[model samples]
Target: MNFQHKTVIITGAANGIGEAIAYGYAKEGARVVLADIDEEKGKYLEEQLRKGSYEAYFKKTD
Candidate 1:
């Protein structure tokens, strides 16, 4: 399935299942939005995705 131009929002994406889902969507060419309380981890993952040429962003949420 082509995921180009698709968007996926994942909550609690700083670690575990959520984090995995974030990477999965990114690998599929989707723009992933990672929302979590762990800002450090979220930002780190966002940077990693960007470095890998994936579209991703992190948003801090409680």
Candidate 2:
């Protein structure tokens, strides 16, 4: 529920379910780490989240 002061690492977070989860955690006040092979989408999502003032970052991974 409340993810305040927490950090969440979500793999495959560039799209689909993982992406949704990443947004969910960020909105719940968690620092969201988005790990995905799709660097473009991941970085885009990270930027969008940041624009909304949510703590989020993207990492390219296999």
Candidate 3:
């Protein structure tokens, strides 16, 4: 549960369970990489996380 300084990669993270998991990791101070085909949603989530001071990035999987 201690994810401090860890790096996590989550696929299909534009929405649903994957997004939840990504945010969970970010909340735990882990670096989160979100991969999905939905670029707009992925970018939006990434921006939201960044604004909240969480380390996160979005990558297109397709």
Candidate 4:
């Protein structure tokens, strides 16, 4: 489905399943918000997604 203009928030998104879901939504044109305590990895993934022209953001949380 077209997720353009949609927003998806994923927890534990610094790696594994959560990261996978984040990419899936982003690829489908959804804006992805990644919530994780791992700031480095979370930020890295956000940058990677942005480089690929996807809308993504990282929020450090417990």
Q: Which candidate wins on lDDT?
A: 4
Please tell me which model should have the higher TM-score, number 1 or number 4: 4
- Each candidate: RMSD to true structure? 0.7, 0.5, 0.7, 0.5
Candidate 1: residue pairs that collide: none
Per-residue alpha-carbon lDDT of model 2 for 1-62, expressed as tens digits? 89999999999999999989998899899999999999999999999999999999899999
Q: Best candidate per TM-score, number?
A: 4
Give the RMSD in angstroms, all C-alphas superposed, for model 2. 0.5
Candidate 1 ranges beyond 4 A from true positions:
none
lDDT of each: 0.94, 0.95, 0.94, 0.97
TM-score of each: 0.95, 0.96, 0.95, 0.97
Candidate 3 residues lying further than 4 Å off, grouped into runs, are none
Report the C-alpha lDDT of model 3 over 1-62, residue by residue, as the tens digit.
Answer: 88998999999998999999998999888999999999999999999999999999899998
Q: How accurate is candidate 3 locally (lDDT)?
A: 0.94
lDDT of 1 by residue, 1-62 (tens): 67899999999999999999998989999999999999999999999999999999999999
Backbone collisions counted per model: 0, 0, 0, 0
Residue range 1-62, candidate 4, lDDT tens digits: 99999999999999999999999999999999999999999999999999999999999999
Instruction: Count steric clashes of candidate 1.
Output: 0
